[model samples]
Target chain A: MRLLREAAVIAGKDLRIEARSRVTTNQVLPFGGLVIVLFAMALDADRPTLTRVAPGLFWVTILLAASLAAARSAAVEIENGAADGLRMSSLDGASIFLGKAAAVAVQLVGLELVLGVAVVALYDVEVRSSPVMIVGALCATVGLAAAGTLFAALASGLRARETVLPLLLLPVLAPVLLGGTRAWEAGFEGTPSDGWPWVQLLALFGLVYGSLGVLAYGSLLEES
Target chain B: MLAGVDLDVVEGEIVLLSGPNGAGKTSLLRLLSGLLALTSGEANVLGHDLAVDRRSVRTQLALLGHDTFCYDDLSVVDNLRFAARAVGRSKHAAVEAADRAVERVGLARQAHLEHRRLSAGQKRRLSLGTALVRDARLLLLDEPHAGLDPEGRDVLDALVRDAASDGRTVVFSSHELDRARGLAGREVRIVAGEAHGGRFPTAAAASPTTSTSGSGSVSSAADEPVAGVSAARAGVDTEMAPGDAHEVSP
Candidate 1:
C-alpha cells in the first residue's frame, strides 16, 4: 500500500507536468493523427484496402506514439539532473518505474482514444466487441509502457539516447504490437471469442513486463 | 577515481571538503551520499553500511549539487512538495515542510512561478530550499555558493548554520576558502583523490568524533589548517559529467 502510494505520487507529478506542458495535445497527438492521415493517403484511395489494414495501422500509430511518450517520460526525469535528486531521495526505484509506466500508459490511452476515432472515421472500419477492444487496449498499453519505461531507464544517460532508445525498445515491443493488432483484428471481424485469446496474450505480456520492471528497475536505475 | 581515502564525521558536525576541480571533491561527496558506489572501499554512513544499505544512507542525507534538481514544468511549491512526498514525508508533513522551506529560503514571493521562469539566483535559492525541506541528518552541498548573489549566499549560510546547530552533519565543497573556513568545524583537503584532515578553532562549538580507516589518515589540531590548504582554485574534470560532477564509480 505504501509503495503504491509512492508510485501514485510519482505518477501525479508526471501527469501534472504533462497537463501543464500539453506535449501530448500539441505534439504527440498531432503526430499520431498525422501518421494515420499519411497512412490513409499512402495506401492510395482504395477504401477496402484501407479498411482491411486499419487495425494494423492503428496499432502502428499507437506503437509510434507510445515510443515518443516513453521518451518524453524519461526526458522528464533527467531534465535538470532531477534523477540525481531521485537517486539520492528515499523513493524506491520500483516505485519510479511503476509510476512512470503508469503515466505513459495513461498518455497512451488518451492517444488511443483519439486515434481510434480517427481510424474509424478515416478508414471506415467497423468494430465488433467493445469490451474486447477496450480490454486489449488496456493490456497492450500496460505492456508497452512497462517495457518502454524499463528501456528508457537503460537509455536515459547514454549518449545518442534519441536514436538508441527506440532501437532498444522497438524490438522488445514487437510482441505487444503483434498481440494488439491481432486482438483488434478479431474485434473488427466481429469475433469476440477469437479476440479473447489475443487479449489474454496481451495481458500475459503486460504481466511479464510489469513484473520484470518491478524487479529490475532498481538495479537498472542504479546502473544508469 | 577516489583512491583509498576514508573519512568519517559524527552527528551534527560541519566539515568543509576543499579541493581543486578534478581532484575528486565532488566524487567523494557523491560516494558518501551513495549516488556513486565506492569502487573498492568500506564506508559506513549514519550506521548503514554503504555496500549493503545505500537506500538508508540516501534517506538520511541530502545532497545539493550543481544541478538544482527542480522540474522545469512545475511551480516552486510543487517541486518542493513533490520532493518532500518523495522522501517519504506524510502528505500533510510534505506540504508543511515545503511551505516552511519556501519561507525560509525567501522564495515565498515566487512560490507560484514555474521553476524555469525563475532567475538563476532564485533557482539557487529554490535548490537551497529543497535541502531545507528534507529532515536529513546529513547535508551534502557541492559548491553551494557558486553563482549566488550576496543574498542567495546569505540564505545558504543560514541554512547550513541552522542545520549544524540542530545537530545535522554537513559536508560542502567550495572554491572560496575564506567564506567556507568560517563555517566548517573541521576541514578535509582532497589532493589527487586522497583526503588530509585539519581542525578549526571553533571545533569546540560542536563535538566531531572522527576516525580514519583504509589508506586515509586523520591529523587533528585546533587552529591548524590542513596541510597544503589554500584558497580553492576553480577547476574542472573532463572525465566526469557536470551533472554528476563527482560520480566516479565503476
Candidate 2:
C-alpha cells in the first residue's frame, strides 16, 4: 500500500511534466504516425500487404516510439540533477522504479491507441478480436515500459545515451515485439485462441520485467 | 574521500564546514546524505548508523547540493509539493507545506511560475525551500551562500537561523568564512581532506561586532557561546583515518 502511494505520487509528477511539456504528444506521437505512414508509402500503398502486415508495422512503430518515451522519462530526472535528489530521497527505490515504468507505460499505451487506430485506417485492416488486442497491448506495454525505463537509467550516465538507449532497449525488446505482433495478428485473423499463447508470452515478459525492476532498482540506483 | 575528520555537532547547533575545492567536504556531505557508500569506516547521523540504516539517516536529513533539483517543466509550488510528497507527506499536507516553504523563501509572488522561468537566485531559493519542506531533523547544505544575490543570501541566512532556532541541526559548507561565522555556532576548516576545527577568535568578537545579525548566540540552538565549546564537537561527530580515507564515529 505504501509502495503504491509513493509510486502514484511519482507517476503523477512525471505525467504532470508530460502534460506540460507535451514531448510525448508533440514529438513522440507525431513520430509514431510518421513511421506508420512511411511503412505504408514504403509498401507502395499496397493495401493487401499493408493489411496483412499491419500488426508487425504497428508494434514496430510502438517499439521505436517507446524508445523516445523512455528517453523523455529519464531526461526528467537528470535535468537539474533531480536524479541525485531522487536517489537521496527517503522514498523506496522499488517504488521509484514502479512509478517511472508506469509513466512510460502510460505514455506508450496512449501512443499505441492512436497508432492502432492509424494502423486500422491506413492499412485497411479490420479488428476481428478486440479483447485479445487489448490484453496483448497491455502485456507488451508493461514489458516495453519496464525495460525501457530500466535500460534508460542504465545508459543515463553515458554521453551516447540518446543513441545507446534504442540499441540497448530495442534488442532486449525483441521478444515483446514478436509476441505483440503475433497476438495482434491472431486478433486480426479472427482466431482469438491462437493469440492467447502469444498473449501469455507477453504477459510473462511483463511479469519478468516488472519483478526484475522491483528487485534490482534499489541497487541500480545505489550504484548509479 | 575525507581523512582525519574528527568532528562533533550538538543538537540544534549549526556547524559550518569550510575547505578548499575537492577537499572531501562534498564527499562528507554525500556520505551524510546517504548518497555515497561507506568504503571503509562508519559514520552516524541522528542516531542512525550509515552502514546499517542509511535510509533512516536520509529520512532525518535534507541536502541542498550544487543543483537546485527543481524541474524546469513544473511550477515552483509543484516542485516543492513533489518533494514534500516524496518525503511521505499526504497530498493536503504537502500542498500546505509547499505554500509555506515558498512564502518563507520570499518567492510567494512567483509561486505559480515554472521553475525554468525563475532567476538563478530564485531557483536557489526554491531549492532551499525544498530542504525546509522536508521537515528533516538534520539539514545538510553544500556551499549554501555561493552565487546568491545579497537579498537571496539574506533570505537563506534567515531560514538557516530559523531552522537552528527551531532545534533542527544544520551542517553547511561555505567558502564565505566571514559570513559563515555569523550563521554557524562553530566553524571547522578542512585542508587536504583533513578536518581541523578552530575557534572564531571569540563569540563576542565574531558576534555582532564582527558580522551582522543572526550571529552565534541567537542562532546556536546549542545555546552555548561560540567559545563555550568546540563547534565541531557539538552535534555530529566522527574520527577519520588520514591516509586511507577511513571514517569512524563513536
Candidate 3:
C-alpha cells in the first residue's frame, strides 16, 4: 500500500509537470499526428493499400512518439539535477520505475488516441474489433513504456541522449511493434479471435519488461 | 572519482567540506547519501549499509546540489510538497510541511509562482526549503551558499544551527573559507580525493567576550562559539531524545 501511494505521488508529479509544460500536448502530440499524415502521403492515397496497412502505420506512429515522450520524461528528471534528488529521496526504486513507466504509458495512451482517430479517418479503416483494438493498444503501451523507461534511464547520462534513446529503445521494443501490429491487423480485418493471441503476446511482453524494470531500476539509479 | 577517503561524522555535528574544484567533495557527499555507488568499500549510514540498503539510507538523508532539483513548471510550494511526498510523507502532512517550509525560507509571497520565474536567490531559498521539509537525519548540501543574499546566508546559518540543535547531522561543501569557518564545528579539507579533519577556531577560541550554552542556539556566536565540544567530550545523551538514536551506536 505504501509503495502504491508513493508510485501515485511520483506519477502525479510527472503528469502535473507535463501538464504545466505542455510538452507532450503541444509538441509530441503534433509530431504523432504528423507521422500519420506522412504515412498517408507515402502510400500515395492508395485507399486499399492504406486500409490494409493502417494498423501497422498507427502502431508505428505511436512507437515513434513513445520514444520522444519517454526521453522527455527522463529529461525532466535529469534537468535541474532532479535525478540525484530522486536517488536521495526515501522512495523505493520499484516505486520510481512504476511511476515513470505509468507516466509514459499515460502519455502514449493519449498519443494512441489521437493517432487511432487519424488512422481511421485517413486510412478509411473501420474498427470491427473495438474491444480487441483497445486491449492491444493498452498492452502495447505498457510494453513500450516499460522498455522505454528502462532505456531512457540507460541513455540519460549520455551526451547524445536525444539521438541515442531511439537507437537503444527501438531494438528492445521490436516485439511490442510486431505483436501490436499483428493484433491491430486482426482487429482491423474484423477477426477479433485471431487478435487475442497477439494481445496475449503483448501482455506477456509488458509483464516481462515491467518486472525487469522494477528489479533493475535501483541499480541503474545508483550508477553514476 | 573519490578514492582512499575515510571520514566519520557524529550526530548534530556540522562538518564543512572544503576543497578545490574537482576535489571530490561533492562526490564524497553523494556517496554518503547513497546517490553514487561505492565501488569496493564498506559503508553504512543511518544504520543502513549503503551497498545493501541504499533505499533506507537515501530516505534518512537529504542532498542539496548545484541543481535546484525542482521542476521549472511547478510552483515553489508544489515542488516542496512533491519532495515531501516523495519521502513518504502523507498528503496532508506534506501540504502542512510544505507550507511551513515555504514560510521558513521566506518564500510565502512567491509560493504560487512557477519555479522558472523565481530569481536565482529565491530559487536557492526554495531549494533549501525543499531540504528543510524532509525529516531526513542527514543533509548533504553542495555549494549551498552560491546564489544567496546576505540575509539568505544568515537564514541558512540559522537553519543549519537549528537543525543541528535538534540533533541532525549536516555535511555541506563550500569554498568561502571565512564565511564557512564561522558555521562549521569541524572543517574537513579534501585534496586529491582524500579528506583531512581539523578543528576550526571556534567563537570561544576567537573571542572570549561571549559565552553560549551547549544547545547551539546562539546565532550571534556562529563565527566564534562551538556547542558540541562539551557534548562530544561527555557523549551526546541520546536517552534525552528518542529521535537521536544513531548517537548511541558508534
Q: Considering the two chains of model 2, state its CAPRI-style docking category.
A: medium
**CA shift of B62, model 1, Å:** 1.0
lDDT per residue (tens digit) for residues A200-223 in model 3? 999999999999999998778766
| CAPRI-style docking class of model 1 based on DockQ | medium
Give lDDT tens digits, candidate 1, residues B27-121.
Answer: 66676676765444455556555656667778777888888888999999999999899888989999999999999988899999999999988
Task: List candidate 1 segments past 4 Å from native.
Answer: B198-212, B215-250
Steric collisions counted per model: 2, 7, 4
lDDT by residue (tens digit), candidate 2, A1-224: 99999999989999999998999999999999999999988885577887888899999999999999999898888889998778767789899999999999999989998999998888888998889999999999999999898888888888888999998899999999999999999999999999999999999999998999898887777666
Residue A42 miss distance in model 1 (angstroms): 1.7
Minimal lDDT window, size 10, model 2 chain B: B209-218
Q: The CA-based lDDT of model 1 is what?
A: 0.78
Write model 2 residue lDDT over B1-250, tens digit each, in one string. Answer: 5544555555667888887776667766776676665544445555555556667667667999989988999999999999999888999999999999989989999999999999988888899999988998778899988878998899899988988899777889999988999889888776545566523333433321111011011122133321111112111222433433323221
lDDT of each: 0.78, 0.79, 0.77
Q: For each candidate, what TM-score against the reference?
A: 0.90, 0.88, 0.85
